[model samples]
Target chain A: MGLLVVFGQIYDPAINAAALAFDRALRADLPDGVIETVPTFRSVLVRFDPLEISCPRLEGHLQELLARQDWLQAEPDDAAQHWVLPCVYGGARGPDLGKVADLMGRREDQVVAAHAAVELRVAMLGFSPGLAYLGQLPEAWNLARRSTLTPEVPAGSVLVAVRQTVLPATPIPTGWHAIGQTPFRAFVPAHRRPFLLAPGDRLRFEPVAEPCYAAFDQADFLRKSGG
Target chain B: MSGLEILSIAANATIQDAGRPGFLRYGLSAGGAVDPYALAEGQALLGNAPDDAALEFAGAGGRFLARSDVWLATSGAEMTLTVNGDARPWRQSFGLRAGDELRLGPPQTGVYAYLHVAGGFQTEQVLGSRSTHLRAGLGTVPRPGIVLPFRADLPHSQQPLKLPRPGSFSRRCFRVLPAPQADLFSAETRQRFLAQEFRIGQMRDRMGMRLEVEGSAAFQAETGLSIASDATNLGDVQITGDGTPVVLLVERGSAGGYPRLVTVISADLAALAQVPSGELIRFQEISRDDAVVELRKYRREINTLKDLVQPVFRDPHQISGLSGMNLIGGVIRGDEEDNHDDD
Candidate 1:
């Protein structure tokens, strides 16, 4: 097949929903010879080998596909629609929860309530392999990213910055504020599809009690389908 | 079987062919010989195919002991090649006896060198290639006392060794084509890039080489634009956030975030590969058509070289001098009377 391009808009409570929507639209229409499409907060990067397809031809095909937007009407099947991610907020699991609450001038409970208030869409998987950038956080919980980046944040960290939540798939340096930790590993390299979360899928992080952390191991939960 | 046993191998040495391509999507770089031209030339000296995997030595070449009688050749930036404490010729094949020690000293001309055995270095191929990805640490270096295996039957050679034309090894001006994001830079900055001379920074490797541009004006107007990271290839001159231009090499990152000002032509990548650190480099802009013409010329030269070494066959039925024979009077002269002739 040649190139297939589709256009659409996606909505999340926090951050810019339009950008995520564009990425989902791009993935749905990728043609043959495309290894993988890289999505960001603003645009999608469609990569192809020049030997298989020329740059000018690919660019021209993309322009035509983008012009047609019929694929947006097709709803995501029930199996691909949404995912419920279990999270533990505050305490050692979320070291920056208190700091985030302080910055927003809100109580810890209020911050937790606001985070679970709306369904977030997986905007993109970037900054690192399999790291899902989920958005948009409620305006009340919206905050700027830290001025200085943390040297190495652990994997499965539920980070909040610029009014969005990011679940890092691997240990990486980030400027986001750590508000919580998730027992569910969104990314597992050994799995056939390493990343469970894909752009356009809905994500809702449910807060759990601190005592519940002992009942499950983060690594084991990642091994199984649902935490 | 004839083979070369490792005596003193350095880090990053591995068997490399003509890079594993078509796997960029799998997050794997086409890991191949850093100096493919030299590798090909070394193989050509043994009358072997260009795709044969040869030992690629990085940083410092290693010491090896010939385990059996075999032919070997070395090519790349001039490294001190010696056999049994006596120097052997570079880019030409020579017979080596058992127990002979072959040593390659630090690179004096280029960073990487290719060592090819008559029957290529036999190594386990992964993903259809023996090329090593050092950053990923997939392959192990040749350890001291390691015995390398090879096939006993060597390909029969019919022609004498034909040397490749000596190429310029020193650093010099490189021809560049405008990159996809060349227009992102200001006109003044672009002009400054063309006018200025850049020094190869010490932070150079197979992945990339940082070029230290002398004046700050090289990035004056294009200071703070945040460009999205994208895949880059060799010769891509990316401007880092700090304003220095880093010329990407063979094993460059699958993608990058810096703005690329220009891309060096594929034909000139070999020349740029030989450029040593601290060497002065200047960029000369050329049209895309001109770049293609240069690449075509290189391809033609290779084809011509290949034709020169092709084996020739003889036809026994077609006898020479048949047309030159003339009937000497009524009776044929010389031996014509004894042989069968038209009555």
Candidate 2:
């Protein structure tokens, strides 16, 4: 029974760096029975077949790889890219918009301005397919998640909670406040890559008029290989 | 044309295979057979390729009409199977000619039963799998009246099937590795987590299974701080805000907000899938090295299953036409047939 766990400080920059570094390195040249590698904000979960590589041997190999390279100094992968996405921030699209503004003690329009002003980093994708966890919302938007969970929210809903924003890839329940809706679909099953956003991409929100945003048919993007 | 015409079905019955892996980056959990070993067992019985597609039915499968000569095998979940109104043995390959009828009753134990045809089922694949990932809206769930196509052109299987080693379908304990957030729980809560037996909640599905806490106070987190949502895979146990721990499965969302307390290792996940609601479950923390060793042992056992298979001399007692069936026929396939259990 060999199951190995490597833990890291969640939200620690260096640990996050290590997770991505190890994840990339592992996928590039993996041993037989290395089932999967999941990189989180602070941990790298390595699932391997023990019959193929003993736990101690697998651990040694991982340690050797980490010790061999300075992951912190590793060059940023050029594959990472940035994109501008459109969103509708109020009315039916954003039921919690006024509440978010009230929580921040700002006018409704001012809240959208502040939210749209910053570039959000995609930290990780999980909880559903293609759902990217974008983080470090300016302190003004750092409202805690609701204690009560909503039974379901539609896909492409932009949520803010715990100083982070998430665009759910699938319609799912959430405790986070939905402040907006976007036409940008992160997941397209028929696409070659399927997920529009990855763990390392950057994105910014551009507020659009309700009519235009409403007319932003999500199905239209399906015809063009999803961007 | 040879196919299986479903007479009835539960809502969740779907075509499944080895699941879609290496696609988590696309925001999908690897949607595959809930009990992959069952698929392997059926595949082994048919001598089909490892990744061949099969039918995964939940409780209450409907009657089916086998059109043309069809070789079929079943695994996972304990059920009462009847061919032409006579009791049929499970976990063995059996043949049915055109118009023969087979009925499967509700599972006696467990929740998923895999139906594998000789050459495997025919279904459109999504992302390299025919599995139904309901959350991601991926493949089809075969229901009543559906004519499920199989590879009738492929050669028929004459191989015997192995009896599942006792305890394969009804085990309750699983080995787990502590998650990164394991230390967040108080020592007392951690103790209770291991000591208390958790019952499976009725809110079970492919995404995850909720555990009934039964007054256990395993609800303590070191910090009020929540981790940034991270990547979650099958078998991760996340403690929800209501203090219930939901053990995620193959159709889980890519990530979530709750603190994950522990994760089940891969080797034990298949058995866990078959565990029906109300079944008590116990978890033990094992060393990483030990877990790996256990997985190796499990893999070894799976690989050697072929040796356990031997051709069965079966019985025949019925004749069925497209219009109707006759069950009282006294014609037995052969005197030397293994119909000793048929009575």
Compare the candidates by DockQ and give the number of the best one: 2
* Candidate 2 residue-wise lDDT, A55-107, digit = tens: 67777778887887777665444677677778899878788889888898999
Off by over 4 Å in 2: A1-18, A25-33, A64-78, A210-227, B67-69, B155-165, B186-191, B213-216, B219-224, B260-262, B315-343
Top candidate (TM-score): 2
Note the Cα lDDT for every prediction shown: 0.66, 0.75
The complex in candidate 1 yields a DockQ of 0.11
* Candidate 1, residue A107: how far the Cα is off, in Å: 9.0
- lDDT per residue for candidate 1 within A169-221, as digits (tens), equals 66768788988887766655445554567666788988888666557565565
Task: Looking at model 2, give its docking quality level.
Answer: acceptable
- Whole-model lDDT for model 1 versus the true structure? 0.66
The backbone clash count of each candidate, in order, is 6, 24
lDDT of 2 by residue, B156-190 (tens): 42434555543766678898888757888887777
**Which segments of model 1 are wrong by more than 4 Å?**
A1-62, A69-227, B1-5, B12-15, B23-28, B46-52, B67-71, B95-98, B118-126, B141-162, B165-171, B216-225, B299-343
User: What fraction of the native alpha-carbon contacts across the interface, defined at 8 angstroms, is recovered by model 2?
Assistant: 0.64
